[model samples]
Structure formats: structure tokens, C-alpha cells
Target: MVKGYSNHEEQVFTKIAELRTSNYDSKSINDKIAENQNFSGIIGSLNLTVENYPELKANEEYKRLSENLVIIEDEIALSRKYYNGTIRDYQKFTQMFPNNLLAKLLKSPEFLMFEISENEKENIKI
Candidate 1:
């Protein structure tokens, strides 16, 4: 599970770097991030396996890694929330009366929110 999660994280970081270098728009980048089926699948599988084999949770290393994973997941969730909040603020500012006129005149691009897919929200079960 650790190895799989590590590989998934590496792949995701690589993809994000590639997208940034390719000058993909924010919406495209956000969509790509949200559409990571491979990573999600790995996470779901890990969760299911852990649920099925409760003894594995008793292993010291497994317990340590699981705690770390939970911390990392929490951090990621907080970051996503922050990103979405920033996008919301930007959207509101751009759409306000005077700001809307200015944005139109300047042809400002719309900011895209970091969105989670419905599948991503579903809990994993064996």
C-alpha cells in the first residue's frame, strides 16, 4: 500500500508539473487533477483491504504508515479547501458590479474551483 501510494503521488506530481509546463489553463489542470482514477482506485483498494484484514492494522509499521497517510490526507483536504475558497473569492470579485465591468474590459479569465468528483466522495467498502 505504501509503495502504491508513493507511486501514485509521484505520478500525480509529474502530471501536474507537465501540465504547468504545457501552459494548460486552470480549468484543464483542475479537471485533470480531479480525474485521477488510478490514484483513487489505489486508495479505495487500500481502504478495503485494511477493512477486511483488521489484523494488518495491528502491525506497528502499518499503524505508523496509516497514521502518516491520514495526516497527509488531512493536509491535502485542507489545501483543496483553501484553493476552492480562493477561487470563490476571486470569482466573486470578478463578478461584482464595477469589477465585472473592469474584468470585461480587461478580458480577464475566469478562475476555476478545485472540484472533487462524485466517485471520489464515495466511501470504499469491501
Candidate 2:
């Protein structure tokens, strides 16, 4: 049962990543990426939970499954942090006074950057 859950989590994570790369640069990509981050976080917590539970850890089969989960969890956490940092830089660029003036003249609207969502703040435990 636990093994099945672990596999499903990995599959979902891979699917979300594939969708993200394929849809990259679209107007809606920002929101989608934010959503992906939340899902990734949830997945990480689940993986960590499996690790902290001693019975699961003692089982050799579960231990093998958990090794992959730990690595993937770290990867997801780093990715989310990187995305947030990139968004911060982009937001700062558009807000600069000189850039704002040029952006207005050039008819370039401000980028709708990714923000950590309210649900993420509330439900996400990572």
C-alpha cells in the first residue's frame, strides 16, 4: 500500500514537470508553475512522513522506495525556492523607476509573476 502511494507521487511529480516545460512562457504558465510548486511541496511532505515513520523505515522494501523519495523531495524544495527567487528578481526589475517609464512608453504591461498562494500558506506544510 505504501509503495503504491510512493510510486503515484513520483508519477504525478513527473507529469507536472513535463507539463510545465511544455507550457513554459505562456501567459498562464506563472499560475501553473505556482500550482506545481504546491503539489511538489505536498509530495515532499508525504515522502518525509514515510521516512519518519519507523515501521516503514525498518521494512527493506520501503527503505529502498524511501531513498528515491528523499532525493526527489530535496529537488522539489530547491526548485520551488529557485522559482520564488526568480520571480522576486523579475518583480524588482519591473518596479524600477527607469524601467517603469520605458515599459509604459513601450506598451509593455507588467509581468504577472508567481506569488506563493494563500492555499499554499495555509495547507502546505513544507
Query: What Cα-based lDDT does every candidate model obtain?
Result: 0.67, 0.63
lDDT of 2 by residue, 34-92 (tens): 66666656655565566555566578876676677668656756776786787778778
Scored by lDDT, model 1 comes in at 0.67
The segments of candidate 2 whose C-alpha lies over 4 angstroms from its true place after superposition are 1-27, 41-57, 105-126
Candidate 2 local Cα displacement, residue 62, angstroms: 1.8
In candidate 1, what are the lDDT values of residues 11-97, reduced to their tens digit? 656765664565445446456555443455556556665675666667898779777767876787798799778888888998999
In model 1, the worst 10-residue window by lDDT is 32-41
How high is each candidate's TM-score?
0.60, 0.51
Clash pairs, candidate 2, are: none
